[model samples]
Target: MSLTWAPALERPDLLAEPVRHALEAMASDGADVAAVEVTEIDPDHADTAVLVEATGWDLRDMANCIVISGARAGEERVCAALVLGHTRADVNKAVRKRLDVRKCSFMPMDEAVGRSGMEYGGITPVGVPSGWPVLVDARVVQREHIVIGSGLRRSKLRLPGALAARLPGAEVVEDLALEPPT
Candidate 1:
């Protein structure tokens, strides 16, 4: 099915201003990012799982996962990471190692909502705080196109993987793994 904007993927009208600003900024940068509504699933759900059960597109050559979490107050601003969809973000070890923090944790729902300005389930990489770090898996660059969040849960954006790597603040890394979830 062709991808198009659907009401189900739109964020609530009450979204915080920062999130809206982020979207506008991305647009100003000539990114083809757009808001879309997708089926409401847990934000923590694996992208590979969504691809298999929802899109039915094998991600063997296209996309990888980008899991993000916020740092503790007075610590790094935010922690954005990339991992293969077949695997989970190495929150305890790899991620922590990279951040050089003694501890790291997922952003709380309320904090995420406040800081990201997007609803918990609807956060999209396209429209996030400008200073926030955007990590990408190097493997994703091999694919000409890939799918990612559209700043809402009910929708996803399909774009060139290379562009994703070039998004402002994005950093490509080679630490991603393909291990299956436990």
Candidate 2:
């Protein structure tokens, strides 16, 4: 019997109401997109290290999503950056250049939460507003599956790395990530 395994994942519906573009685009396109698996978590355990330790999932298979803004007078330019667990976005060089701004900085937590409609730790790339650049490190796009935010701190999402590369405004940039310091 040919069985469908990917759909067995729980909570795909949780993303239903507002319909995040990232996930929606993948599902709608129906080509080269992997099924997504979502898991609920305690709000306090939403951070990387905590979630890793609690679930014992391989650290390398996880990616983080960060929201950043460019400094352009009278214009709102925001980008959602996706990098691996042990890596960080190269905000000063790569990101600034990509966003074509003089400076780029992490969006303030409160502002991020408000604009994303996602909790502080749960902001994923799925539902980012249209035209906002979703910068994804090339390294992340090769993974078979990676855990990312689910627009709510109470859950985390797992899907194909290729799927993330296809999200709206997703730009697969080389060297978008920098190794954490020693």
Judging by TM-score against the true structure, name the best candidate.
2
> What TM-score does model 1 achieve against the real structure?
0.67
User: What C-alpha lDDT do the candidate models reach, one value each?
Assistant: 0.55, 0.78
Model 2, 49: alpha-carbon shift in Å? 1.0
lDDT tens digits, residue span 1-182, model 2: 11123331234644523334555555667744446766667778889888888878777788998999986776878899999998989999999998888988999999988887777788888777777789999989989989887787767777888878877778899999998788
Highest-lDDT candidate: 2
Candidate 2 is scored at a TM of 0.86
lDDT score at residue 39, model 1, on the 0-100 scale: 38
Tens-digit lDDT track of model 1 for 46-150 = 344654565466655434434345455566647556444555566767666666667777767677667765555545565566777766767766666665554
Model 1: how far residue 25 lies from native, Å: 3.2
Q: Which parts of model 1 have CA positions greater than 4 angstroms off?
A: 1-27, 30-51, 59-76
